[model samples]
Target: MMRSSPFLRGTALAVSLVLSAPAMAGGYAKSPPAQQSNEESRHRTLTNSPSYVPIAALTATVQANHRARGLLQIEAGLEVPDAQLRRRVERYMPRLRNAWVTALSVYAGVNYRYGDIPDADRIAEVLQEATDMTLGEEGAQILIGMIIIHGD
Candidate 1:
């Protein structure tokens, strides 16, 4: 029988240790790369993207009219008698729809002229306010329904 040299035995052991250590851990380990900055992402998003100006402008206008309608509903509810209020509300339905549509149209035209969409945050704010005004309010339900029916 031949005896193995001590140096060869030690070298074999070292190689086995290195390979076995990784296998024991189950796989290679590494941290993911850090996220890109917001500014960098925004710049990428805006670059070469087609303008949505008309849609944005229309969204703003519709939102504004939505708010106006809510206010008018509340005011009418408080001021007018129930029977008369219903009639008045019915009468104003056409006007309210027209107002919303007109707002959207004007904004769309402006956006077209400018060749860039306006930010929708302002319009969104107004619409949110209008939505808040309608919730839990008595006469607002009918008015909101009317606005939806006429506007749609």
Candidate 2:
């Protein structure tokens, strides 16, 4: 039988250990190199910049156990593509508010509790739908700046 030299055995073990170690660098990037500020992102939505129409804050009652549990407050803006569309929306403001309030009230009754605002995306989608229905097509969007639900 041949005996292996200690130096050779030690060299083999070292090589194996080095090869088995984890790599220190280089796979895939985990995220983007640059990130936008929230304000910048908000200002840069797809709608035209000068066409935001403000909606008054709306208060709707949410009930539980036949008692008023909370007030849901939503403040939003409509984004239209041009001054003409903006005027059309403004001319029909009463109808739009009525539709928005009704939509929000139904949403609050269905999906929210005393102190929770439903998902932002869900709210945005509902608002967009309401706008589309009111305007007879999909030409405008709703930009919801704040939504708050607080216990009574």
Candidate 3:
């Protein structure tokens, strides 16, 4: 009879244990998790710890009709630390929106092609720049709520 090495036996045991872990835990259930209420979801997302000021929804027309492809719509908000800065942001909303539109339009015209999804982070950065330039300050954080690209 040949004796198996202790190291080999230990390795095999470890592998078996790892493989059987899920079975030991009674396996997976068929049903998914219970859904939370819309109000609860919103409350979780919108925390009292930060001041969130709404930005007007913006629609950017990407490249001209390649069958209405590349049209982008963005809805966002700004999180400013204080009420005063929030007010300032509100006052400069028009300028900020214009800057964002110009930047996003140019970006889409150059970078967006057919069947391509726009990068939300990149667009958020662009919006942040516009906000900072308009406010003459840098603490505002851009929270993008929605980015819809109408592409075929």
Against the hidden reference, what TM-scores do the models get?
0.23, 0.64, 0.62
Which pairs clash inside model 2? none
Q: Give candidate 1's total backbone clashes.
A: 1
Q: How accurate locally, in lDDT, is each candidate?
A: 0.36, 0.77, 0.76
Ranking by lDDT: 2, 3, 1
Which regions of candidate 1 are displaced past 4 Å? 1-87, 111-118, 124-152
lDDT score of residue 110 within candidate 1: 43
Model 2: CA > 4 A from native: 1-48, 115-117
TM-score of 1: 0.23
Candidate scoring better on lDDT of 1 and 3: 3
- TM-score-best of 2 and 3: 2
Q: Model 2, 78-109: lDDT tens per residue? A: 87877788889999999988888898888788
